[model samples]
Target: MERILFGDNQFFAVNHISDEKSRAQAIKFQNDVEIIKTLDYSIDAGVHTFMCTTHDRIATICDYIRSHPAKYEDYKIYPCMPYAHKYANAVTELGIVGTIKEYVPNNFMGSLFKGGVAIMSKDYLSIMELMIDAEMKMFRNIKTPVIFLQNVITDLLLGLGMTEVLVAFHKYIRKKYDTEAGFITMNMPKLLDLLEKAGVENPIICTSINKAGFRMSGGKELYETVLKTRKVRVIAMQVLAGGAIPPKDAIKYICSLPNIESILFGASSRGNINETVSLIHEFDKQYQYDILSNF
Candidate 1:
């Protein structure tokens, strides 16, 4: 994983703080060209990895990336799968059978009639694998070194005591996609406990880690303790607390922490991208200096 990961929340109008900002972003990125341009800005600012949801629009972006191989030769995308809204909207429009027919791979279509049987038999692991394969279709041939399970599913599984499904996802991605499996969750402490208990060692987790305790389940102090003690690789998201904390302060706080392997953030413009990247680098240097001084 890159030390700094560029996120897609801005491109998809996912503002955590202001509805007005979300609307504005929706308007600004209505075109794939504008989205590509902003991504170029991030690349120019030296952030190569794009950590994004597997939204419908992302397939178009993948198409564009596929078209321009030389320009994005080193660029990577961390695809967060099963974009919940996509499935919800699909169910509303297409219904269950239609949705399954549309998403399930052609080769796997032979088992379509067994869907009801699978559901009745509680073969959820098989269903989960099928869904993962379906969601991964768009990212085909893209350099997706890390595939993330979205928080919507990760947290739900945690609440359901379905640690086995989590383990299945982790193992499936490694075995099938040949990539590292990452989990995005709001409740980091609980998820880590479950993953560790399931015998998953040094798992990759992306979660909210900010100064304001914004969406940090189990509060900030617990998260701090987990970070210091846990062996997992954490990619800190929501570090700005929806723009409540100053950029420098947010980056400083994250950099001061232990086991934070990366920082994930979204920005709409080159200026914001450069500023955030610079602040991360600045604070990271300071953090290393403080560590060396203590030594």
Candidate 2:
């Protein structure tokens, strides 16, 4: 995990703070070229890891990255899978069978068979695995060291007491793809315990970690406690608390925390990228010594 991982929320109009801002971003990044330009700024700022949803536009970005080897040689993507909206749209447009046919790779008929078995036998793990394989198809030849289970599914599985699905995702990603499985969730503490019970040791969990509780379920105090006690690699997201917290204070608080392996954020401009990266580095520089002393 990099200390800074640029995200793609801004590219997809996922402004958490304001509907007005989301609409503005939706307009600003309607062009793929604009998205690439903003990403170029992040790469130039020494942030190579793009922790992004597997949005359709990202396939274009991947195409750009794959084509520009000399420029993005160190660049990598941490794919957050099962972009819910994409699936929703596909299902609505194509219907169930058509959507399955469209997404399932290679053996369409065989995938239908598998999909049938999964649906009829309630073998959802098979469906989950199929979805993962389908989602990962666009990322071929790209370096993806970590593949995240998006928070929507992660929280749903957690709420449903579906630990096996979590375990299956963790094991399958490592076994087949040779990459780490990162689960993004709002309930970090509870998810950590669930993952540990499912035999995932020291899992990489991404969650909202900001000065304000914001979307962080189980609250910030529990998150800090889990950071101090658990052997989990946490990628902190929403550290600005959906624009509720000041950037300096948010970065300072997160940097001061015990174990945040990476910080994920998105910005539409070069200035915000530079500012946030600088704030993280400065606060990290100040607290690195203090943190090491305690260690």
Candidate 3:
């Protein structure tokens, strides 16, 4: 079976011996774990500010928390979205004790979103700090804080009513590849240019990478080439090559990647959580591989 790992940053799945359904199940498990953890943290932190909405899940969470008296919160409820007033009222009747937050429709991409705003946690802060420090050392410059700051500026131009015809000069270079199938290859500079044109700031980029028919030396060279451009923020993914690595091997290999900031992992149960945590704790950064041979 493929062993999965779930953490605050991302969910990762790797299997060399499992079927696709098991992978889907692993992702679902990760989603469930995150929800459960959210509630548990709220209760543990003694923060009564529980946010919920008309999504039918509010009731279940409320009942679950209420039934466990030791874990109850002061319970200020927010409709998952502002328009869910009727559902919000029903939630209030169920004994939740707070008003809903106001909403502006145009800013929202959909009628409802996961929380209508971005949620940040300690892990996120730590990762941001790590990125900043890494960029500083890599570039040896303090004025430019993020690696992708320039592109972000270009993307913002669209907001100023500038037409693409004037800015079409930005798309200057392109490249094609004939690498193995499933090998994720991205043109770093081009991607940053695109993100800039769209007004994207320093968002962390995530994508899958495949290591097939190549040794660790080949992988290292490929990564270094991308790194030199300073345009692409690269992170390795699909390291298991679609279940190409056995579960035990997946855990060890993933834990071994030194350049990886955090592996996105997914889980389905408490057992998955425990195993993942254990692997994280067991990671040894001292292990070194030739830049191209490790992958």
Candidate 4:
């Protein structure tokens, strides 16, 4: 069945850490309680699939997914585990039942991470063919690496791999255009080449493009360049900017972007979830924004 997978990068509910009593509750619960609470809220909000980050968090998340009867029946969970000693526990833990997916991020961050390949569903491949050439044009003067996970995983799945997980996922790319000064350029062109070379046939490659906190100053320029070169699709994130952007304003700003396909926000509380959903729906109903003069 075709599914519109919604990657929930930051789904942990850390609301209770605001005050003493809440802080105490948070201590008692650790991150697991908050995670469970988040799962409940996300399920209620109608998220079809989740792309979880961190290794240690994946087990707790999987446990919650397994325990929740409703969520288990409806949604899919893909946990991204970075390669570090801290994550060993989650990776080797027993009783996983092979239901949740496990993935890894590639060498660099931005469009070249291994994480990119894991989420490339079949539908994404169909969309890439038309956009490959255009995507290549965007990085004519840039140097970076690109790889797609869609074709990479086909063989593993066909071979009946032990787990549904795909390790070595790349999400973003970093280029040392200025070594002494230290500036990282997101190598979009290299990524497209890798996807094409790998035969990563996916119509849409969802990007976790956060707009609030960590932003690309040339977002529209990059988007337009890439869009002009290839068929482009983005999953806008960090609308709250790691709590920097106010929820209301964040929603408003995300709603204002013309290129965004979906603004996937993280909500820990039912109220917040409701607010976000209402905002998206409300904004969609009256969604109108002029391409800024900057773009």
Candidate 5:
């Protein structure tokens, strides 16, 4: 994980703080040029990883990345999957059978038949793998070192106690994609335990890890305990608590924790990006010096 990851929430107009801002963003980012400009800003600020959902617009961005290999050579995208809206829209417009035909990998009839068999046999793991492949089709030929299972699916499987699906995703992503699998969840403590039980130790998990207890499930204290005691790649997101927390304090509180491998945040402008990045580096340097001072 990079020390900082540029997120795509701003590109997709997902403002948790205000619907008006979300609408403004939706209009502002309607063009791919705007999205690309922000990403270029991130690259300039020395952050190369763009963690984003697999939205339909992302396909256009991928096309741009594919064309400009030299420009984005040092960059990578951590694609979070099950972009629920994409699938919903596809199903609505294409219908069930058409949706399958549209998404099933080449040899459409064979893939569809196999999918049917998996459904009839209740081989959901197979179904899951197929869905992953379909979701990843747009990311072909791109550097995706870590793939994320969106929180909606992650927490759903958690709530259902169907954590074996988590293991299946881990294994399938590793075996098929040759990359690490990451899960974004609200309940980090429970998810970590289940991942361990499923034989996925020291996996990458992204969650809200702010000081205000904004969305940190099972409480911030438990998250701190797990970070201190357990071995996992922690990518802290929503550290700003959706604009509730100040950048300096948020970065300080999170970077001071025991095991945060990366911090994820989205900002539309270069100034915001530079400010947050600088704050993180400054606090991290202070935290390191403070640690050595205690010794």
Candidate 6:
């Protein structure tokens, strides 16, 4: 994972703080061209990995990246799966069978049969794999090094005590997609415990690690303790705590943490992107300096 991973929340009108800002962002990125241009800004600022949801518009971005290979030769996308709204809207418009037909891979009948059998036999693991395949279709020709389970599903599975699904997702992605599986969750401590107990070693998890503990489940102290003690690779998101903390302060707090392998954020402009990247670098250097000084 890159030290800094760009996110797609802003592109998809996902503002955690202000509804007005979300509406403005929706208007600004109404076109795929605008989204692509903003992504280019991030690339130009030295952020190469895009951590994003598999929203319908992302297919257009993937198409653009596929069309211009040379420009994005080193770019990587970490696709978070099962964009719930996409399915809900699809089901409303196309019905369940039609929704499956629209999203599933080209092996239409084969996948549908498998999905049906999985549903009938209550083999939800197979259904999960099928849904992963369906969500992954748009990212077909792109360089996706890590596939992620979104928190909407991850937390739900956690609450349901379905750690088997997590293990299944981990194994399925490595087996079928030839990529590592990542999980995004709001509750880091509980998920980590479950993953470790399930014999998943050094799992990759993306979650909220912020100064204000805005959306961080299990509180911030437990998260810090886990980071200090655990063997997991954590990608910190919501570091700004929905604009509660200043950028430099937020980055500084995150950089001070242990076992934070990556910092994920979204920005609509080059200045914001550059500032965040620069702050991460600056604080990272400072953190290393402090460690060396203690030595």
Largest lDDT belongs to which candidate? 1
Global lDDT of each model? 0.92, 0.89, 0.36, 0.43, 0.90, 0.91
**Which pairs clash inside model 6?**
none
Name the top TM-score candidate. 1
Give one digit per residue, the lDDT tens place, for model 3 in 65-148: 546554442343211111133435655765331121221222332323344334322233332233223222321211111122
Tens digit per residue, CA lDDT, model 4, 102-185? 322222223433456454443342222222222223223322122223222322332454121221122221122211110112
* Winner on lDDT (2 vs 6): 6
Clashes (candidate 6): 0
Name the runs in model 5 displaced over 4 angstroms: 88-119
> Candidate 2 at 43: error in angstroms?
1.1
Candidate 5 clash pair list: none
How does each model score on TM-score? 0.94, 0.92, 0.35, 0.49, 0.92, 0.92
**Cα lDDT of model 5 overall?**
0.90
- Candidate 4's TM-score: 0.49
lDDT of 6 by residue, 197-259 (tens): 999999999999999988888788999999999899999999999889999889999999989
Error in Å for residue 182 of model 2 = 0.5
lDDT for each residue of candidate 1 in 1-295, tens digit (9 for 90 to 100): 7899999999999999999999999999999999999999999999999999989899999999999999999999999988878877898999977877677666565564556545434666776798888788888888999999999989989999999889999999999999999999999999999999999999999999998999998899999999898799999999999999999889889999999999999999899999999999999999899999998
Model 4 lDDT-worst window of ten? 176-185
Candidate ranking under lDDT, highest first, comes to: 1, 6, 5, 2, 4, 3
Candidate 2, residues 111-212, lDDT tens digits: the string is 557666555356666666878987898899999999999998899899999998899999999999999999999999999999998889999999999998
Please count the clashing residue pairs in each candidate, in the order shown. 0, 0, 25, 38, 0, 0
